[model samples]
Target chain A: MTATAFQFDDVTFAYRTQRALEGVSLTIRSGERVALLGANGSGKSTLLRMMDALCFPASGTATAFAAPLTEAAFQDDATNYAFRRRVGLVFQNPDVQLFNPTVSDELAFGPLQLGWEKPKVRDAVDTVSARFGIAHLKDRPPHRLSGGEKKRVALASVLITEPDVLLLDEPTAALDPASRANLVGFLAREPGAGRTVVTATHDLDIVEDIADRAIVLAEGRVVADGPVLAVLHDVDLLRRTHLVFEHRHSHGGPPAGSHGHMHSSRQEG
Target chain B: MADQRYGICGCGRGRRGALDSLVLGLVNAEAYALDAEATATRPGFLQSVDPRIKVLALVALIVATTATRSLVVLAALFVAAVALALISRIGPGRLARQVWVGVLIFSGIIVLPAIFLVPGTPIVHLPVVGWAITLQGLRSAAFVVGRAETAATLALLIVLTTPWPHVLKALASLGVPAAAVAVLGMTYRYVFVLIEAARHMMEARRSRIVAPLDGRERRRMLMTAIGMLLAKTFALGSDVHAAMIARGYRGEVRLLHDFHTRPPDWVFLAIALAVPALILGLQP
Candidate 1:
C-alpha cells in the first residue's frame, strides 16, 4: 500500500452525554475522491469532523499524517498548524466560512492564518477568485452577495490554503444552478497528484463530477466502499440509504453505449 | 404559552423578547425584516446624502451637545435635532415609537428619576426621594439626559439615513481610525452569517425530531450553535485579516480606491464645520 492517508480503528466519540460517533474503521488513500453519503443525523458530519480533527473519537485510535489523533492530538501548536496545513475544511453554511468584508479577503483567510508572505497570499487570492470567475467581486462585502456568490467565496477561501486533504460538509447545499455547476466543475478539476477529497453530503449528483471513490456511512459505521460509479449505481445499495441519484455518461467510443444510463442529476451550470 | 424572542420586529413581539433592537439592526442584515408584501423603503434625503458629510456633521453635533448644560440652550438644541430628524422621512408613527422605546429606556436607567430627586430651578421634586434633589444635581441630570437624547437621535438618524458601508468609507476619510471601523465592519459582515447558521440549526432541528427536544438535544443545539458561531466569527475574522494582508492591508486602514471626496463634499464639510464652530464660539 502506498502509505494510507488515514487509518481509523473502531473509533467512538461523544459530546458530553450524547454519543455522536461509534465504532468505525476506514482507510482513505491519497488521490481518492470519496463521497460520504447519509441523511442528516446519520453521523456523516461527525465522522467528517473527526477526520478534520474538529472533534476527536472517544474510543479507538484514528491517524492522519503519521500522527495519531487520539489522546493528545492537539498538544503542540506547530504540529496542529502543520496538520491543518495538510487538511482543509469547508463548512455547509457559506456565511460561516466567509468573514471578510470583501471577496479577496475571504480568499486570503487561510493562507494568512498559515502566515504566508504578503505576495503569496495575494497570488493565492487572485488565482482562486479568478478560477471561480469572481474577480469582479473583490471589494464587495460578503453579506450583499447572492447565495451562489457567497458559496464561491467560501470555496475560494479554502482553496487558498492549498491543503493535501479536503474535508467538505455539504459543499453544494444552497448554491444556485450555475453556482452549483461551477462548484462541481471546479471540484472535478483534477486535484494535485497526491491530494485527497472527503465530503459529507446526500447530494449524489456531485458523485460523477468529483468522487473517484465512495464511502457510505450509516449511524456512524461504514456500510460499503468501492469505485464511485460502481458504488453509486448499485440499486440495492442506494435503496438502503438516502443516496439515490445516478450519474449517466454519454458514449464516445466502441462499447461505451453498453454502460450508458438514463440521466445524471447534475444541477445544470 | 412560553414567549419567544421576536428580534426587534414588533409583529414577532408575541414570539420573543419585546425589545427595540431596531437601531443596531437598521443598517444590518440579520434583523432584516423581509416583507414580501412590503415595498422597499425609499431612501430619504438624509439617507441619500454623502456618507462622509453625515459622519462629520453627526460627530460635530455629538461633541457640541456633550459639551453643553444650559437647559434653555439644550432644550432648543433638542427641538432642532428633532425637526432635523423628521426631515429624514421616517414616519411620525415609527419615530415616536422608536423614541419612546429607545430614549426612554436608555434615559430612565440613568437620569429619568434624577430630575425629581435633584432640584434645578426647583421646577419639580419627587414626592418620594425628595431629599436627594439639588439644583446642581438636577442640572447635571438634565445636561446628560437632554444632550444624550439629542446626540443619540442625531447619531441614529445618520445611521438610519446612510448605508453602513458608506459610513465606513466616510469615517476612513475623516481619520476616525481603522480599528473602530473594523468593529462595525465585522458586525455587518457576520451578523447575517450567524443568523444563517441559526436558521440551519433550526432547520436541522425541525427535520429530525418531531417535538421540541429531549433537553439534551436542546442543550446540544444551543451549545453547537454557540460553538459554531464562535468558530465562524473567529474564522471569518482571520480570513478578513488575511484578505487585508493579501490586499496589502497594513496596520493603517485606507479608503477604497473608488472612494473620493468631491468639491461639493468639501463645501458640505465646510458648512457643517462652520455651523458647529459658529454655535460653539457663540455659546458662553
Candidate 2:
C-alpha cells in the first residue's frame, strides 16, 4: 500500500474578509501524479501553500506524511527541518523563488538552509545546475535570465534538496511556445522515480501529459476529482469552471455551418 | 493662444516632459546595472581577484587618495587609476561618460567661487566684475577636483569589476552584520523589479495621453502612480517572504561562500596595497 503524502480534511482558509478555500478535503498518495486545475483566484495556490506548511488551515486539519501541518508542529526545529527536506514548493513566479544573488547560490539555498555540509552543498549546486542545463548561467543573476532560464533555475533550486514530493504552481505560465513545449516534455518525463508531483495549473492542454489524476476547483470549492481523462472529457464541468470556453466557428466545407464546440481554449501550436 | 501664454496648454512642442524623463531615468538605471554585470563577468585583471582582497585594497587606495594634500601625489593617484582601468579592460570612454565628466562639472561649479573669493596673489581679473582670480584659490580648486576625481575612479573601478553580491559578501567578511548584508542584497535584487514595474505604469499612462498634461494634472497622475507602485511592492514583498519560508529560510540567510584565493590573488593584493602606500609615502 502506498503512503499518503497529503491529507486535507474539511480544510477551510480565509484572507481577512475574503475566503480563499472552503471545505477542501482530499488525499494524495505517494508517487501519484496529480494536477490541481482551476481558473485565476480559484484557491489552487492557497491549497499548495497549505500542503507545503507555509500556511495553516483556518478550520479542520491538514496533514503531510501523517504529520499535522500546524504552526505549533513547525515550532520544533527537528520536525520543521525534516519536513522541509522531504518536500519542496516552486512558486508561480520565478522572481519570488529565485531570490539569491546568483543561480548557483539559489540552487544551494535549500540544502544550506537544511544544514548540509559545505562541500555537499557545492556538489549539489553543480549537479543540479548541470542537470537543468543551466551550467552556463550558474553565476548570472536571476533578473538577467530570460523567462525560460529563470523557470529552469527555479526548478533546479528546489530539486537540489532532492525532495520526495514536489509541488509546482502554474509551472508553464508566461512561457513561449517552444519553452512551454520543453517544460511540458520535461515534466512528462517525471524527473525523479516515484516522486509525488502535484502541479497547480489552469493549462488544460498539457494536463494529460503531466498527470494521471485531476482535481478541479471553482469558487474555492472542489467540484470534481477523478482520473485525468475522465475529468478532461467532462465538458460541462470544464465550462462551468471556466477552464474551457464554447468555441463557435464555421468551416468552408460540407456541414460547415457555424456550430458551438467545447474544447481546450488554448490553440494548438 | 491665451492658454499657451499661460503655460497650461501647448502643442507642436517636441521637448521631453517630466514623465518621459522619469521613464528614461528608470530605463537607464536598469541598463547601467546590466552593463556593470557584463563588465564584471569579463576576463580582466580586477575581475579575477578575490572580492575580499579587492575590497580591502581599493578601500585603502581611496583612503590614501583622500589623506594626501599634495597636488602632485593626487595627480599620480589619478593617473594610476586610469592605468588600472586600462588593465581591467574598462574603456577610457566609459570612464569619461560614467564618472569623469559628471564629477568635473559638479565639482567645478562647487569650487568656482573659491577661485576668486580666497585672499592670495591675483592671477587674473574679470574686467566687468573686477574679481581677482588668486593663485592660492586655483591651487585649492585643483586640489579639491583632483581628490574627488581620483577617489571616485577607484570606487567606480570596484563597482565595475566586482559583482554587487560579492561586494556585499566581502563586507560581511569585514565585520558587517549578516542581517545587514542580506537586506542590502535583497534591496539590490528587487530594485530592478520595481523599476520595471514603474516603467510599465508610465508606459500605460503615456499610451492614454491625447494632449499635454498641465503641471497640476501631471503632479496628480504621478502621485497616483507612485501609490499604486507602493501597493504592488508591498504585495510582492509578502509573496517573496512566503516563498522564502517554503524553501526553509529560517530567519537567517545562508549563501554559498565559494571565494578561494590563489597565489596570483595574493600578488595582486600586494601590488594594490604597495601602490597606494607608495603614493602616501611620496606625499611631501
Candidate 3:
C-alpha cells in the first residue's frame, strides 16, 4: 500500500463544553483526492485542521507524513515551520483567508513566510496567480474583489506555497454558479505528481469531479467511507446523515426532467 | 433572493426615504475605491518613486508646513503642493475637492467664530448685535486655515499617489513594529469587508420591511444592525487570525520584496526635502 499521508487514530476533541469530534479514525494515502462529506458542525473542518497541525487531537493521535502530530511538535520552531510549509488549509470564508491588501500580496504571503528570497517569491506568486486567472487582480485589494474573485485569490494564496497536501474547508460555500463551476474545473485538473487533496465539504455535486473517495461524517462519527459515486448515490445513507433533504421544486417549472431528485441540505448547529 | 414587492426598487416607498443615506454611503464607497485604484494605475511622478521615500518626504513636508509661522511660507507651501499634484497627474480638481471638503471648509467653519471674537481693529460690522470682524482676528484665522490646508493637501497627495500595500510595506520597513503593521494591514483590508457585510444586513432588513419606518424606528433598527456587525467582526477577526497562523505567520509579516531606492528615488527625495527647507530658510 502507498504510504499514509494522514493517519488519525481514534481522535476525539471538544471545544469548551461541547464535543466537536469523537473517536474519528481514518487514513488518507498520498496523492488521493478525498472528500470529507458532512453537514455543518459535523467535525469535518476540525478534522482537516488537525491534519494540517493547526489543531492537535484532544485524546488520540493524529499523524502526518509519518510523524505523530502533537502540541510539542508545533512548539518547536523548525518543526512548526516545516509542518506549515508542507500542508496548507484554506478557510471556508475567503474574507478570513485573504487578509492581505492586494491579490499579489496575498499570493506572495505564504512563500515569503517560508523565507523564499524576493525573486523566488515573486516568481511563485506570478505563476500561481496566472494559473488561477487572477493576474488582472494583481494590484486590486482583496476587499474590493467580488465574491468569486476573492475565493480565487484565497485558493491561489494557499496553492502558491506548493504544499504537499491541501485541506480545503467548504471551498464552494458562498459561490455563484459560474464561480462554482470554475472552481470545480480547476480542482478537477490533475496536478502532475504526488499531491494529496482533502476537501471538507458536503457539496455532493462536486464530489465526482473533485475527489474519487468520500468519507462521510455525521454527528462527529464516520458513518461511511468508500468510493464517491457509491457513497453519494446511496440516497438513504445521505438522508440519514442529514446531508440532503426532500424539497419540491414547484415554482420553477412543470415537472422538469431529472429535477425531481432531492437537493443537498447544509445543516446548521 | 427576496421578491421585489415594489416598483423600481427592492424596497417600496421606504427606499425613497432611505435614499439620502444610501447615496451618501455609495459616494463614500466610490471615493474609497477610486482612491485605491486611480493612484495604482496611473504612471506618474509620485507613483514611480519608492513608497518609503514618498511617505517620508511627504510626512516631512507636512511637519514643516505646520511649523512655519509665516503666512507667506504657508501660502508658498500650499502653492508648491498644488504644483506637485499637477505634475503627479493626480487630478487637481479631486485633490482640491478633498481638501476643500475635508480640511478647508472644516477649518473655515471652526475659524469663522474666531474672526469676530478676537480683539482688534474692526474691519466690518455685521448685522448681528455687538459683532464685528477684526483685522487681527481675520489674519490669525487666515493663518489657521492656511496651515490646515497646506498640511491636509500634502497628506492627501501622499495617500492618493501611493498604493495602500506599498504604503504599508514602507511603514513596516521604516521600523514600525511588525505586529502593529500587521494589525493595520488587516484593519485596512477588513474595513471594507465589514462595510459590505453591514450593507448586506441593511438590505436584508429593508427587504423584510413591510412598511415604511419612522425616524425613531429606523434609528433603532440601525442600532441593531451595528450591534450585529460588531459581533460578526469579532468572530471574523478570530478566524482570520487562525488562517494566518495556519499559513506560517509567526508574528512577523514577510513580504515578497524589500524596499529598494533608485537614483530617481534619491533625486525625488532630495527635491522633496529641499523645498520645505528652502521655504523655511528664505522666510523674510
lDDT by residue for model 1 over B157-251, one digit each (tens)?
A: 66667655666667767787877776777776777665665555544644564443455655676676667767876876665453343222345
Which candidate leads the pack in TM-score? Answer: 2
Evaluate every candidate with DockQ and list the scores: 0.14, 0.72, 0.74
Using lDDT as the measure, the top candidate is 2
Q: List chain B TM-scores, each candidate.
A: 0.71, 0.88, 0.85
Report the lDDT of model 2 for residue A127: 86
Residues A1-269 of candidate 3: C-alpha lDDT, one tens digit per residue: 78889998899989878898999999999999999999888999988888877778889988898888999887888888888888998898998999987888888888888788889888887798778888999988887788899888888899888888988999888888899889888888934368899999988888888899999998888989999999989999998988888765555556663354577863221
TM-score of each: 0.62, 0.91, 0.87
Write down the TM-score for model 3. 0.87
Error of 1 at A230 (Å): 2.4
Candidate 2 residues lying further than 4 Å off, grouped into runs, are A252-256, A265-269, B1-15, B115-136, B275-284
TM-score-wise, the better of 1 and 3 is 3
Q: Once all C-alphas are superposed, what RMSD does model 2 give against the true structure? A: 4.4
**Best candidate according to DockQ:** 3
